[model samples]
Target: MKSHYSDAPKAQPILRHTLSVLVDNEPGVLARVVGLFSGRGYNIESLTVSETEHEQHVSRITIVTAGTDQVIEQIRHQLERLVPVHRVTDLTVQGESIERELALVKVAGKGEARVEALRLASAFGARTLDATVTSFVFELTGSSEEIERFLRLMGEVGLVEVSRTGIAAMARGAETI
Candidate 1:
């Protein structure tokens, strides 16, 4: 006989989600957080951590991942149970949150290519963080999509390398979590 669950339809495609977690900034906290992801076989696309309130000894951990609605909920629930995690906010469900990432892109080229890189960077409002005879490093901050677009354009010009500070998000209004 067929299994009872065999007729169930497959779940929907996984959508990108951003989660902000407040935790104690004590040592080994980040490792524990990261370990939870790895141990559970979850994939983290973007991760950033910073001390939010020094006086309160709280740090914010922002993580971006792709998962179905149910999976996202499960992740959030699990995070909430972590000892060091003070709070977990799924910005995707919380509504109207501001999300941004910072990237430093290095492009190495000469002559017209160099000029083109500069022009493109200017168009994207990227600041020149460093410049050398044949290379330039641009610092940019924007939404993930905007960063992807900038990287694509830079690839055409001569992208050498990139370092990114992953998504940091917060709710728009008076909501604090």
Candidate 2:
């Protein structure tokens, strides 16, 4: 008899994943879904839910979380077992997915900061949602990384407030979830 304990495999790196869940548009469904994550000690980075199919009474919940491959698979399986969940698609694992988030940024500045802010906003393709003498509210829709960079630059200029819509993702091509 021999022991091979020293040959254990390396631990998998934690990776970010986006899960799109199709669920019934009814009460407590969202709560249950969230509870599952909380109870299992899973951390949700971003979450967005809305009734996508009004006539069908169905909603789409997009959740971004970080976990190992095994943990992500387990979460997906558990979600599928829930009564109200119709489907759980891991957009990260799915090939060629599109992920986007919208953010509203407000900056108040009097001098050069204002000019720089406007220039950066133009470069980032952020539209001027509202503008006043002292402040401007810019609307930006892009990947989370892009939004973060925009916010960081704005912070250096004259960032006042920010409101963000969590990540909304879908598989590219003709697939529907």
Candidate 3:
């Protein structure tokens, strides 16, 4: 006999979601929002929050997560129900948006290796922030994929460390979130 669960519908594909939340810029507001995710056992891949309107005392939180469509919808609903949250926009589904991340990549090498690193950095449009005979610190900003690719190349050479400034996303149109 067939197993009972075999007849169940297929699972939805896991997809990347970028959620933008507008909230009151108040103490403990961020903690409460993050608690909701941790309490629910959801994973947050990237989070960037900052006050966008100083006079209005409103902040924008951008979170990148991976989940199915249903789970994403649930997250949006829960965020809306929070007292401090004024709006929740799923930039992934809303419309075209600009998403970018900044990274400070440190590579240590000398001679030919250092030369190659500098060449590659120039090719990728990375700017050299600090440099010495042995190590170089480069600042790069671009899509996540581009940053990853650049890091991989640096690794092949002599990647020492990397500091990434999570993701910052905003809708492209004139509409405010």
Candidate 4:
């Protein structure tokens, strides 16, 4: 049997990636963007969108997703083809970047459990947004992993509920995307 001259390397395991997209701040633009992800069956772990440049009528959308290398590339390419999209930057491939997520965690417990929850929140730099005799609401801002860890710990103590603001990511240096 003749050996095939395969130039392709082995497939890599799926990895998490952060993507930043600049698009026109027009009606239906956000929907189109979200549709692209949904239509492709890609799961968006975290998503955040905000107007960044008023003069240019441009908005920035930051999305965190997990997929293999091929999936990531496909996502970037599809986003670029959208009519309202102006630029797509894959922060995961762009080098050092900063990614942050904000979450509000509520805990309701009595006795030592309540005390332990407060102590743990303090250690994680989470601020007490609201507090009552039986419940405490904490506001935390950090990486996704950090929030996950905090939530897990809070569950062990007494987690009532949680709300998150998704992800906001940007490249670290002078280069702006």
Instruction: Provide the overall lDDT of each model, using Cα atoms, as 2-decimal numbers.
Output: 0.93, 0.96, 0.96, 0.94
Residue-level lDDT tens digits of model 4 in 1-177: 665657567778999999999999999998999999999899988889999999999999999999999999999999999999999999999998999999999999999999999999999999999999999999999998999999999999989999999999999999777
The sequence of per-residue lDDT tens digits that candidate 1 reaches over residues 2-33 is 89798899878899999999999899998988
Which residue pairs in candidate 4 collide? none
Q: Show where candidate 3 strays beyond 4 Å.
A: 1-7
Query: Which pairs of residues collide in model 1?
Result: none
Per residue, candidate 3 scores C-alpha lDDT tens digits across 93-142 of: 99899999999999999999999999999999999999998999999999
- Summing lDDT over every window of 10 consecutive residues in candidate 3, give the lowest-scoring window: 168-177
| Of candidates 4 and 2, the better by TM-score | 2
User: Candidate 4: deviation at residue 53, Å?
Assistant: 1.3
Put down candidate 2 lDDT per residue, 19-86, tens digits, no spaces.
99999999999999999999999999999999999999999999999999999999999999999999
The C-alpha local distance difference test score for the whole of candidate 1 amounts to: 0.93
**Candidate 4 error regions (>4 Å):** 1-9
Listing every candidate in turn, what is its Cα RMSD in Å to the true structure after a full C-alpha superposition? 2.4, 1.9, 1.7, 2.1
Clashes of each: 0, 0, 0, 0
Query: Of the candidates shown, which would achieve the greatest TM-score relative to the real structure?
Result: 2
